[model samples]
Target: MHPGGIKTELGRHTDPVAEAQMIRTINQRNAAAGLPPFRYKTVPQGAATSVWAAVVADGDVVGRRYCEDCHVAQIAGDPEVRGGVQPYALDPDRADALWELSEAMVGERFDPLN
Candidate 1:
């Protein structure tokens, strides 16, 4: 699920020196597209959609991007548009690549996907 932004101090451990530079660069890109800089969801609210996808939603919901409040999202093909899923990026091949890379990074510390 594209959990959107969360209000937690999620990245507090990041290196302060690099954080501002990165945020500036990214927000500059967002500004170029006429979108506001990144904002966040509250930590408690952030978990709702994920919990729905993982525990409550049925198998038919698998492999689809979800958003908060648990409805099927509007697809966001154009960056100018507000919230929505970019379905082209969510295919199985990309997912497998992500899985393999994650397993390579932490296979010794955690159980890996089959």
Candidate 2:
């Protein structure tokens, strides 16, 4: 699902040829933006499970995991907005509260991986 709450449907089978083409397209755009091309890797289920268990043990929460909920709340506030969702124009008080909460949760630096 996209951050905008749009659901994307994918084919059931893995298509390596199509995936490679998509990666090439992504690399072209990344190169145009002076960014490094992404490296793709396939890992076994056991490896992936161990990695996820380690991450959870480290107390790291993926912020984007909650993006759907946030977007739902944002869109629920206005259904007829031109951009499909209202801009998150928080007032000064709300902004300050958010800042304080963030600081308390993750300190000054917003590093979820650390």
Candidate 3:
């Protein structure tokens, strides 16, 4: 799930100064494009969906992409919109290929994945 800018320690690890600048630039672009303002969430809020999928949701809903909500599909994006989901994002073949590539690159298939 895309956690939607959670209050992570990410800023501290990376160049916080640069990330702040980036946020401003991106917000300006989003505003100019008429998109809603982005916001941040606490760690618990960000972890809610993941925890739901792990502990509460049925097997059918596991391993699927979500946005912020548990057991919900990511909002399929329109091609006309900026930052929209691409066709490949929903392609089974592409996903399989990416999985194979990631395992190879990492030099191991994770225990549960096998």
Candidate 4:
């Protein structure tokens, strides 16, 4: 997780060096757990917008499930919401803002059926 509980994909003022260090830590933990290491990449500007647009087009239920799977238990929170099981990113207003920004950036309308 990036500093201040921000998602990496959001490209929110992340320090590249710090992010690389965090990725190393994550890989170390994964190795200890016998899990495959995750590949890390510096997210490019607007990439999150494109991805968010696609997710929004996929429908809220699907998007929610995706968020839960990817961010759940990863974001900071109390015991009941540990590991992002209930990510703040999934909040409706935030989701809406993401979708809007995505559309504005990409110049595409989200088609739920697409």
Highest lDDT against the true fold, candidate: 1
- lDDT of all predictions, in order shown? 0.68, 0.45, 0.66, 0.52
TM-score attained by model 3:
0.65
Estimate, for each residue in 1-114, the C-alpha lDDT of model 2 and write its tens digit: 123212124333658698778668767766766666755323343244344544443334433222222222244243232222334533556656777798898767563442
Q: Show model 2 residue runs off by greater than 4 Å.
A: 1-12, 42-114
TM-score of each: 0.53, 0.30, 0.65, 0.34
lDDT of 1 by residue, 31-72 (tens): 877878866677767787788778887757544455545656
lDDT of 2 at 30: 65
Candidate 1 deviant stretches above 4 angstroms: 13-39, 62-69, 79-82, 107-114
* Model 3: per-residue Cα lDDT at residue 95: 78
Clashing pairs in 1: none
lDDT of each residue in 1-114, candidate 3, tens digit only = 555467676756768788788777777767877876556768888788778877887767555554345555544454433354466677878878888888899999954352
> Which runs of model 3 end up more than 4 angstroms from their true locations?
55-63, 78-86, 109-114
Q: Give the C-alpha miss distance for residue 97 in model 4, angstroms.
A: 0.5
Clashing pairs in 4: 72-83, 72-84, 73-83, 73-84, 73-85, 74-83
Tell me the deviation in Å of residue 69 in model 3.
3.8
Residue-level lDDT tens digits of model 4 in 89-110: 6587877788889988999988
Which candidate would rank higher by TM-score, 2 or 4?
4
